[model samples]
Target: MTSLERVSISIEKRLLTRLEKLIKSSRYTNRSEFIRDMIRSKLVEQDWANERREVIGTITLIYDHHRRELSEKLTDIQHDHHDEVLASTHVHIAHDRCAEMIMVKGRVDRVRALADRLHREKGVLHAELSMSATGDSLR
Candidate 1:
């Protein structure tokens, strides 16, 4: 087990009240777990802010597969970044629509660029990049 430490800080009453409400609404049994998650979230954000840092992310895209040449274009884009893309899955949402989720692991800039390219393709109805980390520093 990892060693544990205790610390305390002061906050404004209003902010503290808001934190309490958030904890209760989220059904957290206590404040420590909530604070730990808040810290982890900020750390992940910091990791992605450094462009050279290794990161992981998923790019989700929804598009109309019936659009002329759209599927081929998307496939070409993925192949262009094949080294960085870990895996991908495609689902047929309907006769005309499809959804794709591409898992990527690479430097922040490369991942972001790949996501942008996928999102900018003409037939993409929606795209979202969910950023995460390699988990080397969470401890």
Candidate 2:
């Protein structure tokens, strides 16, 4: 097991009260766990901001499947970046619309590029990229 270190810091009374309110609403059991998670989230954000950092993310897309050549173009784009494309799944949102979630891992720039390309496609109704880290540094 890893050793634990207890540290202390001071904050203004008003900020502490606000922190308590956030902790209660988020349902965190203790201040230490909540603070640790907040720190980790900030670290993940830092990693994403570094374009050279290797990261993992999911590109989710909603589109009209019947649009001419749209599905083929999307598939071809993924194939072009096959090394970064980990896996993908497609499901029907309705008779005419489909959703795709593509898991990717690579340099931050490449992942962002893939998402951007997918997002700008003609038939795509919406596209969002959920950023994440590989967890090598978080622990």
Candidate 3:
């Protein structure tokens, strides 16, 4: 386990009250835990901002499967980024719709580019990329 440190911060009374309200609404037991998590979240985001940083994330896409050649196009795109894609799961949502969840591990820029390519394709209804770190620095 990493060493822990205790510190104190001073804030305006109203700011402290607002922070307490937020902490309660979020169901955090204490302000220290909430602040720690917030810092960790920001750190993860910063790690991904570096292009060379290796990261893991998921891409979720919803599209019309019945659209002309859309399924084939999507598969082709995935194949093009085979090195970065760890796994993918596809599900049929309706007669014409499908959803795919793609797990990817690669450099930040490469992963973001692949997701952007998939999201920009025709017939895609929605696409979302969830960013996360490999935890090399967060110990």
Candidate 4:
């Protein structure tokens, strides 16, 4: 484990109260860990905002399997960017609906482009891109 350092900061009473409430609601054991995680989250966001930085994330998509050529188009797009697509899983949500999650790691711009391509498909009912860190910046 890394050595620990103690630091202090001043904040308005109202903001401190809100921070405590957030910690309780988030089920964090204490403020220190919560603050550490919050900083890490900010770091990940910064990494994603810089297009040239390599990052990791996932793209989730929901679509209608009955839509003609929709699956083929999605597959083709994934194949075209095979280097960025680390893994993928597909689920049959219902008779006509399907869900897919693709894990990706690459330059931020490339990952965003892949997500946008998937999101713009004709049959895509919903899509979300979840940004994350490649862990190199976290530690």
Measured by lDDT, the strongest candidate is: 4
Model 1, clash count?
Answer: 0
Better of 3 and 4 by TM-score: 4
**Would you list the C-alpha lDDT of every candidate in the order shown?**
0.94, 0.95, 0.93, 0.96
Please rank every candidate by TM-score, starting with the best: 4, 1, 2, 3
lDDT at residue 47 of model 2 (Cα atoms): 95
Please write out the lDDT profile of model 1 over residues 1-139, one tens digit for every residue: 9876899999999999999999999999989999999999999999999999999989999999889999899999999999789999999989999999999999999999999999999989999999988998687
Q: All candidates' TM-scores?
A: 0.95, 0.94, 0.93, 0.98
| 10 residues in a row with least lDDT, candidate 2 | 130-139
Per-residue accuracy of model 2 over 20-97 as CA lDDT, tens digit each: 999999999899999999999998999999999999989999999899999999999999999899999999989999
Better of 1 and 4 by lDDT: 4
Q: In model 4, how large is the Cα lDDT of residue 139?
A: 90
Q: Give the TM-score of candidate 2.
A: 0.94
Model 3, span 13-99: residue lDDT tens? 999999999999999998889999889899899988799999999999999988999988989999999989999999998998999
Quality of model 1 by C-alpha lDDT? 0.94
* Lowest summed lDDT window (length 10), candidate 4: 1-10
Model 3 has an lDDT value of: 0.93
Looking at model 3, the pairs that clash are none
Native-referenced Cα lDDT, model 4: 0.96
